[model samples]
Target chain A: MPPRPRRSYDQFCAAARALDAVGDRWTLLIVRELLLGPRRYTDLHADLPGVSTDVLASRLKDLEQSGLATRRRLPPPAAAYVYELTGRGRELTPVLRALAAWGAPELAERRPTDAVRAHWFALPLLDAVALEEGLVELSLEEGDFHVRRGSDGTVSYGDGPAPDEPDARMTLDAGTAVELGRGTLSVADGVRGGRIAVTGDGPLAKALRDG
Target chain B: MPPRPRRSYDQFCAAARALDAVGDRWTLLIVRELLLGPRRYTDLHADLPGVSTDVLASRLKDLEQSGLATRRRLPPPAAAYVYELTGRGRELTPVLRALAAWGAPELAERRPTDAVRAHWFALPLLDAVALEEGLVELSLEEGDFHVRRGSDGTVSYGDGPAPDEPDARMTLDAGTAVELGRGTLSVADGVRGGRIAVTGDGPLAKALRDG
Candidate 1:
């Protein structure tokens, strides 16, 4: 990428550079809420009730200044303002979805079922992305699990038993499988160590290894 | 967005939901750091020196579970992990960039220049989308300000005297112009109120109205 004019930076690391803008806890969550649609200030406040009005105002100002959101006045005498993600802001949906998917299982494990329902803003991003063709089914005798595609390039998590005719199959405990999905451990290594098992096409098996 | 799979409500939004399988906070920051390139865990620790080893280990687990990053075991049996973003994780570059840009000005205002530099991950997204083409020069008595569209679609902000061959001219104070950029007031309103003066191209004048 070419250098941004006027903005000066001595650091060479890109991630550090990115953190300089969004490292705050509220900002990414705000981006996540905007992915759903344009919202009024009160609407955003309701969605993220934990955020103070002042902080929301500041974040909105920052977002507009950075050109991620455009704030427009609504029609009539309401004097209300609507904040919509610019095209640039909308592009962040995928990152938020992937992050949500990665976090869901742990979230499920931590909270009781009754409490999770209140979180309207916490939906995963994959739900918004178009799912790709081909399905993979896997079953374990004992475990709670979710699946994410290495090849489909859409990161998501699902509940319950895998479909009957998936393109491939792998069986492992929930935690270990999630670890594999995260790319922390290689499938080949896991298989060699007896942490995971395969029961499908050899090519698909190899593909998992490659992933 | 599709409904979340069967589970009760509380499970949905707790810290568990927010926390990735890799862990929370630090992992995302670590991934944001690696999105630029690979780095040793110690180097990552340096970027976020406040994080303890136990916390770092936990965060690495969560990041690995999310597939946003990968840890390669390097040579000589050193048992060290060098982390880098995966193809999926790299997609977050723009999001990180936007956050950096949003935080930069405030970080500068609050902290000394020598404090950790503000990262600018959002610049690419801004350059890719928000910028509009064409030059609109606003000439003030103190000095002229130029807003021009770059080939890449980024809006350039510069300070200097007016150019001789200007397509249009508008006289306004710098502070008011910045306020307009914030969407707090309208340029046409300002002009009608005699706070600003416009000359030259009619279409350019209209563009400023829209802006």
Candidate 2:
């Protein structure tokens, strides 16, 4: 492969520089997908419904060149290639959270042409959940996904529940989760109102109840 | 104008929903410009050098329809239309800050074609500064700008020092400011080294020193 030429904004400002790296359409979203852990190209394509195959491949390449992601082959049994975020790339959680919170009001209603993903709600719900460091499993009507925030402030989410025993698990319906994103309801309020159920005996559940 | 349709990603996820709203080309960059308060169409055009007139106008229109920005004629004496971010739009500070921080490492050098703005560096410096609720003014070689965070976590920044008396003032040379953004130098270290001058008896300067 030839050396990738850098075509940054060339501006000194950090925001512009950052945009130069991830400002392209579909780049950050790719980062959003990979935050779940390593994913095969086909899995990435399935989750990111609207992106073209060419664009997806191109973005993965850009992310690799940008040092935000790395591709590796699964050994033996799986025999597949996967892409995953690096530590620097993982720093984007706060950025995604901020963007998701800012854009939540835009989702008042779903369009007929729109696509749905259950794990997509993870970042916004991150703010709604307790700040305690633990895994949170959410069993929504549409599908299941889980979110975990570490003590160092790193946050990651993936499809289904925690791989290990989750610190806490919540069986929340979609309506309650959407309402929480809309700022119309709180987690504690949802729990109290029976809109959301708590199943873990961790500090997270305790915090949610007290909140 | 007929009711501008809301073409949302019918996804249940907040991050996807956000991308549906702000995922368009140059949208967040426009948001970056508007964060400096308001700008005349001509001003926006000049600052956003590479954007074609048509795309800039179209993006501005989308912003207005999305309620992220609005246009109004300046009163009487200096009558002209200017676009400004709504309160909801200004909420992007943290998002922008996160992005700037992530992108800071990529600013290895400046190219000749790059246009430099003193204020363009503000977002990155925001994270470098103290978390106190006060305005800090910067008089750099390129231009002037100010940033302030409110008690409620609301942050607003603009082209110059506080319109009135700023809570604090700091005169930072370009080199020192860039160093701070790059994570190589601390604000206190700069202040102590005389590369950054601290002024005013406000809590901000005190915090910078302690920081």
- Chain A fold similarity by TM-score, each prediction: 0.52, 0.93
Docking class of 2: medium
Q: For model 2, what is the alpha-carbon lDDT of residue B179?
A: 83
TM-score of 1: 0.39
Which predicted model would earn the best DockQ?
2
Residue B78 local lDDT, model 1: 74
lDDT of 2 by residue, A1-211 (tens): 7966856655677787888878877888888889889999999999888788999999999989888999999998999999999998998877788888876776676667767778887777777874688888888887888878888976678897778888777888766787777778888888899888887787887887667
lDDT (tens digit, per residue) of candidate 1 on A1-211: 4433323232322333444444444676677556546678887776664578888887787677667898998888976888888876765555455555545444324333222222232243223211333344445554322344556574434434453455556666544544543445666677777877755564655565444
DockQ of 1: 0.11
RMSD, one per candidate, in order: 17.0, 2.4
Interface RMSD of 1: 6.5
